[model samples]
Target: MNNFTKIQDKLMEMGASFVGCSDVEAYLPENLKKVKYAITVGVRLSDFIIDQISDKPTYTYFHHYRAVNTLIDQITLRGQIEIQNMGYSAMAVPASQTVNDLEDRYSGVFQHKTAAVKAGLGWIGKNGLFISTKYGPRVRLGTILTDMELPIGSHVVRDGCGSCRICVDSCPAMALTGNSWFAGCDRSHIVDAQACSEYMNRNFKHIGRGSVCGICIRVCPKGFSK
Candidate 1:
């Protein structure tokens, strides 16, 4: 097997529910442009915990979210190491982190969703979550940017959320704009991040340190099929 295929297999064995590679040269900053390829890793959240969510996030679901993020980080870190051992450069982006330097407090060092979507693993839902075909928005994602040349998936250029307003209607914060997503669409067209953040902080702070609310994720009908 090729080196990339071997790495992919190893990541799956390490507990990644989904993995994809993407050519994200255009998305990288000037200094980091050398590593144009990205390896995206996703871990499916527990359907039982996600289904337990109603209007607010349960403590169990909150813990599950953090735990899944930690797992994804571990998987991506291992993938990065494996790539480096193959004589290539790699950097594993954190599973979930807010970069203060960016105008968007919700922004990370690199957006995992970007890599995920470009990898054809999912699309951006109206609620601003990565909507996976198999798990809807109930999946935590991690990414490893690398200089290693690997086969990449076809870029998903269109949104899959056609006429679905469940997440928008279910959002207590009224943060969702009910707009469809496109490859280059602005996030403001689909969700009000500030409103979503404030609403969670105001209402569900007692549950998960006010960092989570899963109403939109629970309401999404995609991935519910057995």
Candidate 2:
């Protein structure tokens, strides 16, 4: 098998529910621009745990979210190491992390959803979550930036959300703007990060220290349909 296929297989064997590669040069900062490709990994969340979440976040769902993120981190870190052993440079972005240095408090070092969409694994939902075709928003994503040249999937440039506004209407924080996502659109056009963050902190502190509220995830028809 080719190196790319081998790496992809290894990632899946290590617990990734899905894996896709994308050319992400445009999304990378100048310092890391040399790493032109991104390997995206998604770990599907527990359907039972997600289903248990109602209007508010549940302790079980919160724990499941953190557990899935940790698993994704492990999978991506292993993938990164495997790529490095193949004589290429790779950096695994944290599965879930908030970097305050960015103007957007919700921003991470690298947006896993960006890579996943570029790789055609999913589209961005109105709720600003990565809506996987198979699992909907019921997935936690991870990414590895690499200089290795690998075959990449065709980019999905169009928004699939259409007229759906379930997430927007259901958001207790009124954080979602109900905007359909398109490539290059600002995240604020879909979600108000400050409002979402503050709402969770204020109301859901008992669950996940107020860092999570699964209302949108639970209400999404996509997950239920699957």
Best by lDDT: 2
Q: Show where candidate 1 strays beyond 4 Å.
A: 155-158
Candidate 2 lDDT tens digits, 159-188: 667888988999999999987887899888
- Residue 124 in candidate 2, Cα distance off native in Å: 0.7
Q: How much is 203 displaced in model 1, in angstroms?
A: 1.2
TM value for model 2 = 0.96
Q: Could you tell me which 10 consecutive residues in candidate 1 have the lowest summed lDDT?
A: 152-161
Instruction: Write out the backbone clash pairs for model 1.
Output: none
> lDDT of all predictions, in order shown?
0.87, 0.89
lDDT (10s digit) by residue, model 1, range 70-112: 8988898999899999999999999888898887777788889
